[model samples]
Target chain A: MTEHGEQREVFLGRVRAALGHTQTIVPDEPPAVDEALVRLATHDDDLITMFCDRAASVGMHVDRITADELVDQIVAKLVELDAKWIVVGFDSLDQADALNNAIEAADIQIVNWLAGGATMDVQFDTDVGVTDVHAALAETGSLICNVDAKHSRGLSLIPPVHIAIVGARQILPDMLDYFATQHDATGIALPSSQAIISGPSKTADIEGQLVTGVHGPGKVFVYVVEDV
Target chain B: MSASTTSLTLKGHDILFPPLPYDMHARADLATGDDQLQRFINNATLSKDLQRREVCAQTFGDNYDAMRSLAAEIKQHTLDHLDHYLEQFVDAATGTGAHVHFAATAQQANEICVGIAKREKLTQCVKSKSMVTEEMRLVPALVKVGVEVVETDLGEFIIQIDDDAPSHIVAPMIHKDRTAVARAFERELGSPYTENPQELTQIARNHLREKYRTADLGICGANFLVARTGSAVICTNEGNGRLCTSVPRVQVAIVGIEKLVPDMNHLAVLLKLLARSSLGQPITVYNHIMTGPKRKHELDGPEQMHIILVDNGRTEILREETREMLRCIRCGACLNACPVYRKLGGHAYGAVYSGPIGALITPMFKGLDKYPDLPHASSLCGACYEACPVKINIPKYLIQLRAQMVRRRITKWPDRLFYGLWGMSLRHPATYRFGGWVQKQMFRAKARAAGTAGRGDRYTDRGWLSKAPGPLAGWTRARDLPTPPSNSFRYWWKMRS
Candidate 1:
C-alpha cells in the first residue's frame, strides 16, 4: 500500500515537473474575497436596518423586542392574528408553551413537528408555526435550516406563514460560510439533502413572472432574537 | 438472481457496448486536433471550468474540503443500505399513489415501459436527456414498434435530428459547433440561417412545447428515487423535465435500480454534490419530485405514475468488481476533468457514453472482450478519479480492463511477435547490445557514404532511411522520421561513466 502510494506520488511529481511550476496548497486561509458580513454585525442600529430592509423587500412586517419581552410579544401577536393552533419545533416546545400560557385567554393547540404533520394541520388548524433558525445570512437576509431528527425538514418549508427565531450569534458572513459550517459540523458525511433556501418556495417557470409559495411556504417571518 | 434473468440482463447490457476493434484510429485522427470541433469543445469545457470554480469559491470558500467530504459521506451511507431504503421508498411512493415496477434487465424494463405505452396505445412519446434510455436504446425499441420518440432536451434534440447518438454525456453536442448545429436545424427544421445558441434554444423550446402539450406518454430518468416516499426526483436546467412529468397523463420514470436511496435525507446529500460538481450552481433551476399520478382532486400532475426500476445490467454490474461505477450520480464531473477527453472530445470513445466514466461503464456493461480497445484509450493520468465527486477510482478500473484484454490475448500474431521480441530484448543485455551494435554500424556506413554526415541519412525508394525497418510503418504515418544516430545515449553515458 505504501509502495502504491509512492508510485502515485512519483507519477504526479513527473506530471507536475513536466508542466513546470507549482502552486502552494494552503487551507484555513481565505481566498481573497470581500468579507461583506463584517458590516452587518458592526452595531445594534446596523442590525436593525438589515432586518427592516429584508422584511420590506419580502413584504413582511418587522418588530423588535428584548429576550424577556419575547413571550409576551409572541402571545400578543398570535392573539391578534387569531391563532387557533400553533406548531412549534422540537426544541422550541417549552418556550412556545410559555407563550401559550401568556395568552391563556384564547385556546390554541401546538403540533410538535414541522414535516408533513405541520403542513396537514397548520394550513387550517394552526395560525402560526414557530421554528428555531439554524443560521442566518445577513447578505441575503435568509434564514437557514439544517434538517436532522431534532429539526424536521418541513418546519421552514411547509407552513404558509413561518416565524423563525434566529439567535444573533448564529449569523454567518455569507451563504457559503453558512453552508460550510453545516458541512464541517456534519463531519465527513452529510445528509442526502441540505437545501440552502434564500426565501419561501418560488417559481417563475410559467410565463417567467415571479410567484412565491408555489409549493413551500407563502410567507416567512424571522424574529432576530437579540442578546439580553 | 436466476440464470435466465442473469443472461437477459447481460444481453440487454450488451446493447450499449461500442463495436469491437474500436474504430479508434479514425476517432483519434479527428479528435486530436479537429478544427471543426475545436470551438465547441473549448467553449463547453471553459464554461464548466469557470462556473464550477466560481460557485465552489463563492459558496464554500476555504471550506470546499468540508463540503466535498460531507457530500461523499452522505452518498456512501445511502448506497450502503439501499435495500432498506428501496423498500421504504416504494412503500412511501405507493402510499402517495405511485406504482413502482422492478425490471431485472433492459428487456424487462423496456417491456414494462412498452407495455404501458401499448396499453395506452400511445403514438407519440417525448423524452428528456436520460443515460438509462441511451443504455437501453429505448428510442430504437419505440421506433421498431412504430412509435415516434421526441427528444426535448436541446442537446438531445440536436443529436436526434441528425440520427446521431449523444457524444458527451452532459453537453452531448460538445463536438459540434454552431455552424453544424445551424446546418442541422436548416435541414431538419427548415430553420432560417442563424448561428446563435440562444436562437437555437428558442427554436427547440418552441418546437418541444407543442409536443409536450399533446404527448401521450412522458418518459424520463430519475436522479434520485427516495425510498421513503417512492418519489422520483429530477434536476434539470430546462423545465422540460418538469413539464414532461406533470403535463402528460401517463408519466413513466425509467431508473437504474441503484438510484434508490433510504429517504429524502439521503436525497439531500446527492443533490449537493450533483449541483456544485455539474453546473456550479447552488441548486438546479428545478428539483421536481413526483409522488404518483395526480390525486383525485389535484389540479396538475400525471393521471398515472409508473416507475420502472431497471436492473438491465446493473445487477450484474453490482456483482462485478466495478460496482463502484453503479454509485455514480451521472454528474459528468469525471468527463470534464479528463485531459484525454478534453483532447479527444467525446466522439473518439464512440458510444452513447464517453469519457472516463464511460470508458469504465462501456466495457463492464457489455463484455471487456468485445470492447477491449477502450481500456487502452486512456493515459491512466488518474485525473478522472481525482475529479469524481464520489471519488470512484476510475483508472484502477481502466487498468483492470487492460489486464482483462491481455488475458483474452486479443492482439494479432504479428503484433504479439513484435511485443514479445521487444519484451525479450529488454530482459536480455547481450541480445540488446548486439541489436544496438548492428543499428550503429548501419547508421555510420550510411552517414559516411552520404558525404554530408551533418545532414544525416539518405532517402531510400520507400522514403527516408532512418532505418527503423518493417512494422514501424504505423509510427511514421503522420510524423517526420528521425535518422538513427551512430551511437545511442546509453552507450555515450556508459563511456562517460
Candidate 2:
C-alpha cells in the first residue's frame, strides 16, 4: 500500500512537470469582476412576474397568494390534485399552525420528514412531497433546495409530484445573484447536496421523444407567498 | 475510518487502447444502408442544434458571446494553475469528511474503486451517466469482482442492458430507435415489448427504482469540481443523479482532473451555458452539488464519500500545444453542429468521445498512432468552433494533429508523395499553370470519352467520373469528380490581361 503522502507528492510532481513549472507560481489576485455579476446585480423586472413566467415556461405551475391565504391555497391545491397522503419538510413546520390547520381541514394523512422515522418506502409511496426553497432564481426558474436535517433531499425527489413554497423575498434575479448573496452571507462551504430543480424530471432519451416523470417528480407546483 | 487507515493500492491500470470494434468505413457503409436510421440521426442532430440556438438566444440574449468568452477564460485560468487548484480541492474535500484519492491511470482508478467496495463490503451498486466511468470501463472491472452494478439513468440503463456503448455524450442512446429499446427490455428484463417512449421510460423507472432503493454503493461523475468548496457538481435532466448520491450508503465520484472551477461564482457562469448548449433547457432538472458525505447533522446522504481524481491522460493533454482540448465541457453542441458527425454518426468515430471535440482529444488521449483517422474526420468548416460553449478552436487542434501525423510519417506513403508533388508544383507559377493545363486536358478528354461536353466550371455540370486513375480514385468513389474546365483560370486571366 502506497502512502497517501507519497502518492500526493508524485501526482503533484507529475502535474508540475506537465505544466512546466519548476517552482510554485502564486495565484494572482482575482479581478474585481464586473460582467455577469453586474448584469444580474439587481432585479429590475418584477420578481413575481419574472419568476412565474420563467417557472411556467419550464413546466412548473405557479400560483401567487398572500401569507394569510396560504392555508386556504394549500388546502385547495391538495383538494384539486386529490392528494390523499403527503410528506412535508420540517422547515415548513414554523408555519405549522397554518399548514397543520390546512392539512387537518383537508383531512389528508401527512408525515413530517424531519420528525424522524420516515423510511424511503414511505417517502416513495407518498402522493406528494412538499418543501420550502432556500432560494429561487428567476433567470432559470429554478428552486435551490439545501438538504439538511429538517429538509430531507427526498422531500423534493422521491414523490411523483413536488410542491415547493417560496417566500417572495427569496426569489433572486439569477444564479449569479443567488451565489453572491448566499455565499457571502454563509461561508464558501456548501451542504452535502444542493439541488437546483428547474422543472419536473424529464427525459428525451428514447428516440428523441420528450417524456416527463422519468425518475423524479412529474408535476411540480410553486406557491410564491406574497407576505411571508 | 481515519484518513491514516486509507491506503493507496496501485494495480495494473495502465492505459489500454482497444482496437476499433468495427472499421470506420464499414460503419459509414452501414449508416448509408439504413435510410430511416440516417434520417433519425439527421433529425435528432438538427433539432438539437435548432433548440440550442433558440434557448441560448432566449437565455443569454445579446450576452451569449460574452458569456462564452468568460467561460473560456475561467477554464483557461483554472487549467493554468491546475496543480494549485487541485491541491486546494483535495484539502477542502478532505476537511469536509471526504476521502480523496489520486490515480495516475484508469487501471489504478478501477482498482481504487474496487478496493473501496471490497473494504466497505458493498454488494450492489447504482450508477448515473458518467462518460469518464465509461472511458475507464469501470463496470466490467467491478462485475469481474462479483459486484453487481446497475445503471440508473434511463438512457444508460437501456444501453447497459443491450451491452452497447454510448452513441452521444448527453443522450447516450441517441443512435437507438424505440423499437431497439423495446426489444432490449423485453429480452433483458422479461417485460412485454412496447414501442411507446413513455411506456419505455416507465418500464425503466419501475425496473431501476428498486436498485436505487436497495443499492449499497452509488457511483457518479462530476460535470465540474468546485475548487473553493470541494464540491462535485453533477447536472442531469433525470433525477437519477440525486438518487445515486443520496440513496447509497457509500458514494464514489470519478472525476477527470480537468473539470474544475475556482468557486461558486465561476460555477454559476458554467451553469448558464451547460444545459442551454446541451439540451436547450434553461437548466437541467437536477444540479447536485455534493460536497462530502452526509454531514454530522444530515439525515440523508452517503455515510462514506470518496472522490477519485483520475489523471489517465489529462496531464499529458495539459502540455504545450494540445492543451486547449482540455477545456471541453462535453455539451455535445459541437457534435450537433458538425456536418460529418450528422452524416456518419458517433459509431463511425469508434472512440468514447466523438465528433469535433472527440476528433481533437482522442488522438491526444489514446495516442496519435491509435486513432490516426480521427483528425481527418472534420470538414474544417468552423461550425464546431461557433457552437462550442467554451469556444475551443477545434479546427486549430485538428490541423495541429494532422501536421503532427504528417511529420511523424504516420500518413500513407502514396498520400504523402501526392501532396509532396502538389506542394512542389504550387511553389512555382510556371509549374502550377502547366500542371493545371495538363489536368484540364485530362478532364476534357475524360468528359469527351464519356459522351459529355465540359461546358461549365461547376463539377456537377460536367459528367461524373465513376473511376479515376491513381490517387484521385478515392474521391471519385463516393462523389462525382467534376471534370476541370477546358481552360485553366490562369489562362483566362492571362487572356483578359
Best by lDDT: 2
Identify the runs in model 1 with alpha carbons over 4 angstroms from their true place: A1-228, B1-21, B31-33, B61-85, B143-146, B183-191, B428-475, B481-497
Q: In DockQ, how does model 2 score against the reference complex?
A: 0.57
Cα error of candidate 1 at position B269, Å: 3.0
Q: Tell me the tens digit of each residue's lDDT in model 1 across B183-208.
A: 88889998897776656655665576
Question: In DockQ, how does model 1 score against the reference complex?
Answer: 0.03
Q: Lowest lDDT 10-mer window, candidate 2 chain B? A: B6-15
Q: After superposing candidate 2, which stretches have Cα over 4 Å from the reference? A: A1-6, A31-33, A36-41, A90-94, A185-188, B1-23, B440-464, B478-483
Tens digit per residue, CA lDDT, model 1, A169-226: 6666444455344435422323322334445444332212244544345466666667
| Model 1, docking class | incorrect
Per-residue lDDT over A104-201 for candidate 2, one digit per residue giving the tens place of the 0 to 100 score: 67888887656676666568778898788899987777899988767787889998889989898889987878777656854556778889999989
> In candidate 2, which residue pairs clash?
B13-B107
Interface RMSD of 1: 15.3
